[model samples]
Target: METANRIVLPAMDMNVSEGGEIEQTEIDHYVARAKGGAGLIITGACAIAFPYGAASMKEPGLSDDKYIPGLKALADAIHAVGSKLCIQSTHHGKVARIDTANDRPVLAPNPQDYSYSMKAMADCTPEELAKMGAATAGKQTTFKTMSKEDIDWLVETWADAAERVAKSGADAIEIHVAHGYILGVFLNQRDNQRTDEYGGSLENRARLACEVISAVKARVGDSLAVIVRVSGEEYGQEGALSLAESTEASQLFEKAGADAIHVTGWGRNPFDNFTDGPLPNKVGAYVESAGHIKKHVSVPVIAVGRMLPDVAEKAIKDGKTDFAAMGRQLLADPELPNKLAAGKPETVRPCINCYLCVGESFFDDTPFCAVNPSLGNEKVLPLRPTSASKHVVVIGAGPAGLESARVLTERGHRVTVVDKADRLGGTMWFSTMTTPDNERLLRWFKQEIKRLRISVKLGTRATGALMRELKADHVIVATGAVRPKPDFPGGDLPNVQTGDTLRAMMLGTATAQEAGFVLSTLGKTGRLSGLTKSPEFVRQFTKYWLPMGKDVVVIGGSLVGLELAEFLVERGRRVTLLHEKQQLGLPLAMPRRWTAVKDSEAHGVKIHRNVKVDRITEKTVEWTEGGESFSAPASMVVYADGTTSAAPFAAELEAAGIAHDVVGDAGAVNYIHGAIHSSFKVASEL
Candidate 1:
């Protein structure tokens, strides 16, 4: 194994295996990780038994000895690249949706109501519940409660599966004892309530987990390493195990024969666990939990929580943990370890933690990385460079343009990036400044550009003449988009500002102070501290400009409008958002969009949907709402309708006969994901 503070790609639901057999494509996925310099990989959760233990139908299994060959093939592929492979064995107790179990009732430590409280295990007849309980005891589900004889059989069944895995030539085995699954329910006080020896006190509650570890170790012995995965904390629940309790549980498992501990955390919301907190950004956020256990146990501690190399290195340097276990980061770039080891960490694709990968898992059981298009398809797509040489010019320095330049340069292309703006990151420079979390995107752009050694020229607008002057073999246009302000009566009136112009003024790139103040007063009474920090704009408003302080109305309900309203509201402005659509920020995704709407409403931002603004006036806006003509008083009005491609140089490129591609909002007004994906795709062609 490679001896470095590198990462171990943790098990995730890839949904590639079928009926305990490894698919060739799945084999390729693991092989690519090995080739990418992953020192170790833990395969997705593999069921040890049918129905009860299976987390999903697409998951692999080791219940039958027939799966040995497929397991062997998977192991051999990783071994070929000098990497170790492990299988994660899991049993989804109550959390296993009954729908995924072929209509069979899910097994849990105890019968409880689901979150919605609409479903309960008690809803089923006593006889039916007993049948499931008996099945867990290894008997046919024809009886109530498991007989003593049945319980003995199920334990042996677990041992039998472990023995089979040992003979399958796997390097290690991880017990999935977290995430509200079977073992998790037993360990969590909120779930388990058995009066018997299997529940109650901490030690009693840990009985099931300890038993599984002992059984697996007894069957496999020192031949294969045994790891226990546990959640550090259960969020959104009361009386759940805290970090201390989780540490205690980890220690118990270590003493029960587990060779390692993989620490994770459970959250009510998906984003909470992956990106919402400092834990996700802090390398080895779980290290403290592991450190607590490490202090009491001899077993190795594995830390996982969206770990980056810098954080990983710091954790190791501080002796906080033994290994860095990364899941999403690996999905973004499996070669993370190699990149770090070579001191080329900037090349690692950053995981934005948008949860697109998690969304894919729910849709198809096959997880896909938003940033790394080759993730799930790595088995079929060649990830290595096809050619070593090409001359390329990337137009536009937006996320798409920079991403294209980065990828092309990595493929051994000579790349020159040009943009008309005075800096890289077309609209992103403004977008990032909108949210604290988004600032990382801007950091990523600058870091990647410097790492790739691609030539960059700011303030150099791309033209057909420019491409020809550079003798570019390939050109990529990522000029992005411009704010679209459709014709409205008095559209050209003073103080009628577009979102882009306001952004420019906020960033101090333009001297539109009067327009900025007018827009600011439209949203807030007078407080604009949260919207921007342009001292000059603030001073101009406090001095020469008149603060409308008048009731203001805004047109459009897109993201820009919502944010602008928020800015205005924070500044003590009375703001009302008017749109023709029924919903605001229609392009936003669910849950997040829902949350944004709630936040907007919390700020007292009025929404007049199914309305149209027909004219702008010095002190009022004329509009029709719900089929009635009306006018709303306004000191200033800002339009955040949408955007359109702004590639004035496209004609120049056509005239110069230069081959090029338009991407990002410049090609089609969209979000950042589209822009980066488009850039990467086009860059790959180059």
Candidate 2:
């Protein structure tokens, strides 16, 4: 492939096959990227062998010649738009579970005896370990490992696959040697422990990978370019190769005749370098890893870590790396390169890094970008605008409203956005104030709205009179919902307040000193003391108010409650979370929720499940835990019980016979995705 100032759309699992045949959905998905003007389109991981190589049952396969025709069609569609295509060949190692029903034994570099019972590496028997080692050396499975005799066989398999891919008309081939898969295991010391020629040292460990590249190169010659994807850092263990070690491996691969190196970092550890951090971490963070390897090799290096165009441009301009390979960014906006080239970068949708794409791959077999609704729906939804022009009125400036407005405007509609608040963002304004990390999201929203040029009227409520005057052809009521506060005993007292009220006060909207004696009751000391303090303290106080004082008790230990308690305890405030439920953050995913719980526990936050708050008196809260009555003194009572719509305009909209839609907290309390999705749907319909 010619080295241009363009980005390569890297392969991501887009589950678009049934019975190993390319579905039309897959074709449309790749074609969209090609049409969007991507220089190269890398198809998602395709299995080299059937049940053994497949990561999931739904993943597409190129295990047999029969799969070639379907792949040919995908290549044709992409090529029609003048963009080159590459197909990634992959084999899952121990990550593949050996099902007795399938009658295939899972293969790994070394034996792994740890299953459901084993916690660490010590749980394995010597015999089982030996069997595993033997199996890796070409034993039971139909797809045998490369012995000296089997070396030709393995080479032939790759050569034949490459030839078939060439016949299918792809421009390049990428060897999947990352994410702890088959080839990756052979490279990492944690997995490959063989004392043999193909294991002990870094050179030995890299032998299998080099052999695969050599085989593929010899078979295809210089007719196609070969790219190797490598994990720059393996998360947990010290035995794993670092950037310097991986650079040596890259040198070996380059000498073995690879065209380009695509660098990535992975493993189970969340905080590992290049794996975890903020949005900036996602952009250009892995370029240094690529640079380290690039210095040792002659081939071009591709940098990938949630790259946006500006970031990717900087990397290329600064000579950090040769080309930028994008996965999530392309998923978010397939036409990103084209848009950037056309000087219309604002039209691109940014990836929010919500992990919804990763979550979908486990179940649906294909990744779905949250911000880009067209993802996974490529077969059904047209990427280009099809709707006829119409005047669409989107009420509210929340995420949903903004998304709806953006989509509608893009679909050749005249969009007018109105919000009761004096600004674009609704609850997000206050919600985002809680954390500095989340401020980027708000900035993204602001940037997108300004770029779209959608006319927005701030502090303007949608009414029947306004609707009639504007003569909107369609009305999208994304006014949003409110946080519900049911009547509780003593709730109407001056000291009692809802979550929104506290948030608003702490956010500097409502003066804490002016909110009557309630502020004084919370141990404010004086009027100005609580109201006019540092912005950081206000943020901390608003989000997790309990930690502002010496001792605090939090009611309703849901996601917000638990996070608040955790934050408070971390800030040196003693916290006791009282929840009526059996578990905390029940609505959240098990992995994230459990991780939060464990971290919170580690931070010394006391958790009391199956507990109910009876009432709150000025300085104390009464509650029952495990059916026993308990009382705790409070410096301040913080409500993290979630929010309900506090906007009074909804009833007025209904009373005035105005057509409007309520979304987010107004329709019901939900997460960021809910708000964005709801708004998109409403806007699309309008």
Candidate 3:
């Protein structure tokens, strides 16, 4: 509680428990972050009673003393490293996402008619819509208003949890009253319309929150800190829960013996929640919420939502909040605080705020982080140097290759990474260009590669002789995925190129091979023929886009195709995307897909879904949609669809008798999450 930093790990629902008991996965997880040096680590939001108002299935619970042993295990593990622990106690209330009531109505202050997911149904495909519906199926969508006895009983349950939290050796207890949960709904005018003394007015609405705080404080005395987290404003209809109302509530909570506050807000749009998805900005995503609360609350305050160290430090200095609560950032790099303290902040890995962490929770409710591969499965993470160090050769310099080389070096192995492209980032160069948050990560990877001093051979392709020449004890093939090959008729036409090639060409940074292919096209016939020999001349020459004309038809509906469509549309080109899916970008991360879909639609790029391509000619594409054949005019056709891996080097490595493991897209077309996580796991073992 007293030593290293002011950063706190806020409570997140990482559904990893079994029947309300902690698993080793959860233990290893908190212990790793505790060991990595967070000042205070809060356990995932633990529910009080079961069978009603539960936020998630298998959420860690404290309804009975029988659960204390598991809670004690987590608290002991966190405290073992001299870090303090805080147990977050909550009741899901109306925002309960699970059905624990055995088909009985889920209790709430009033009828809980709908969820934020319901609002997006009109915009989603049937599959996506079904997912949203399934998320709330039997989910206590309607509520019977809480009676005075029910409210008092819930407060008692909260107090019981607090007492158990203190008994379990935790240093504090945080009451979750945010994100449209029970207490948060009670604090909102839009949700609570009862005329009783427990509702209808600001003071009456705040009474329940104050009572919970008082009850918890009475149980813990001064032995534990009492923290209350709240939504600074309801994001639904205006005047629901205004800033003034929240400030008043904060004051009431302080007067009721609350020790601190964590300020976050609900979603204005269903897609724009407390999570990172659809958030217009990355850093300081919710500073205003916390800052407003700090002005009226005498106790310490914490702020979360993608607040990096620099912004966090500034916020604390400016008294916006006493501590910056980091959720995803700590998951991305547990050593963030250590790096900042050591004045080595540049090495700290950043959270790209892709919402994969949050999205995974919605899907499987597991402990997963896109940037950090070792979150839930921390037992497999290496803690010491390997027993024996050997030379390791990694092919390709994409995320997979570099991650393998980095981890292999950490295990005391000598590593050499080779890539055919001159740049360090493979397809990420194009990806990072669109998502600026990833650009920083790209720079960090490049910097780490330099810092590690691992030998890198860019623009060097590996073959059998190269593998045999290195004589490595192990070889890792990360020769990442290539664009899907064109398989339709007329695919071999000169006017067709893949998305990767087109992106590189448009950026004036085409690979050596691609440059030659483009330059050779104008040779022997046009005035620009000989200019291709000069790099600058050719780069400047291609902007006129000799091979790719103004009107282009991009074929494919995968993420690649959608992103390519976004890029081309932004560049002021007339573009159309043809794919087989009913909706083009349904499977991408919420934030990424939202931006791409909006950008593509706003630019007037036509999307032809469920289309069948019959043939592609030099300047035209023939396709059929809804059983009607139509011909689309095009100057060039870019292929972005396909999920296949092509690693010609595998045969060479096999013939050379080199021990090799294929990873990333080379083994199969794994996305970035799968590619990076599996590569790190494999490299850690080597």
Give TM-scores for every candidate, taking all chains together and pairing residue i with residue i.
0.80, 0.82, 0.88
* Candidate 3: residue 605 lDDT (0-100): 85
Q: lDDT scores for all predictions?
A: 0.69, 0.68, 0.75
Model 1: residues >4 Å from true position, as ranges? 1-6, 98-101, 117-154, 269-284, 379-391, 435-438, 472-474, 486-498, 511-641, 644-648, 655-657
RMSD of each: 7.5, 6.7, 4.7
Summed backbone clashes in each candidate are 12, 17, 0
Instruction: Please write out the lDDT profile of model 2 over residues 271-388, one tens digit for every residue.
Output: 2222331122345667778777777888888887777678788878887788888777788778888888899776666665555675444343466555676787875355347357
**lDDT sort, best first:** 3, 1, 2
lDDT of 2: 0.68
Tens digits of per-residue lDDT, candidate 1, 220-264, equal 998888989898777755766778778788888988899988888
Q: Which stretch of 10 consecutive residues in model 2 shows the poorest summed lDDT?
A: 115-124
lDDT of 1: 0.69
Q: Kindly state the number of residue pairs that clash in model 2.
A: 17
Off by over 4 Å in 2: 97-103, 113-155, 269-283, 344-346, 379-392, 412-414, 434-441, 451-453, 461-474, 485-499, 511-611, 614-634, 642-660
Error of 2 at 237 (Å): 3.2
